[model samples]
Target: MAAKKKIRSPELEEGHLCYICGKEIHGDHVYIKTRRRSELHIHFECMPGKQQVN
Candidate 1:
């Protein structure tokens, strides 16, 4: 079986920008690591088709 890559959600900072909205993250947010090993941040509400996870 192939191993899954770990996903990390770093704490919001003063200058962090959302990947989708391109605005500073002031509240709840999420993040993703690209294939090139770079991190992208996004606001929670900006995620399309978002669903609540149990």
Candidate 2:
């Protein structure tokens, strides 16, 4: 049996670049920890299939 790598979230900085748009995150954004154990930052507007809640 093989062990699965655990995903972890790293601290996000204000000037961190967005993984999706490749732009600097200055305001609203989200961070995701990939299966490869890498942290990806993305802006809300740039997020794919993003929907607004009432």
Candidate 3:
């Protein structure tokens, strides 16, 4: 059987923008997450990005 990787503890910090939309977000409502351990990425809209011109 293949080896399993261990997940480290959750790391969070303020001003952590989303990797998707580059929006500013907090660990509160509409936070960021991932199934794998990459970067604590979030949505661009979730951080601080350009709003819709609508």
Candidate 4:
């Protein structure tokens, strides 16, 4: 079976920006590591439709 991407919800920092909306993550957020090992910081509300971690 194929491996799944690593998804985690970490504490949001003061200047963390959302990868989707390009705005600062104010409240809660998620962190994901892609197959290519790229780290993405995304907002909870702006997460991709099919890739909601929570």
lDDT-better candidate, 1 vs 3: 1
Using TM-score as the measure, which candidate wins?
A: 2
TM-score of 4: 0.55
- Candidate 3, run of 10 with poorest lDDT: 25-34
Candidate 2, which segments miss by more than 4 Å at Cα? 1-12, 51-54
Off by over 4 Å in 1: 1-13, 51-54
User: Per-residue lDDT of 1-54 in model 4, one digit per residue for the tens?
Assistant: 999997665653356878988998766789899999998989878766756556
User: TM-scores of the models, in the given order?
Assistant: 0.57, 0.61, 0.31, 0.55
TM-score-best of 3 and 4: 4
Task: Output the better candidate (1/2) by TM-score.
Answer: 2
Q: Encode model 1's per-residue lDDT on 1-54: one tens digit a residue.
A: 999997665652456888898988876678799999999889988898897879
Worst 10 residues of 4 by lDDT: 6-15
Candidate 3 deviant stretches above 4 angstroms = 1-12, 29-38, 43-54
Q: List the residue pairs that clash in candidate 2.
A: none
Models ranked on TM-score: 2, 1, 4, 3
Candidate 3 lDDT, 5-38, residue by residue in tens:
9876556345666666666666553454567755
Winner by TM-score between candidate 4 and candidate 2? 2
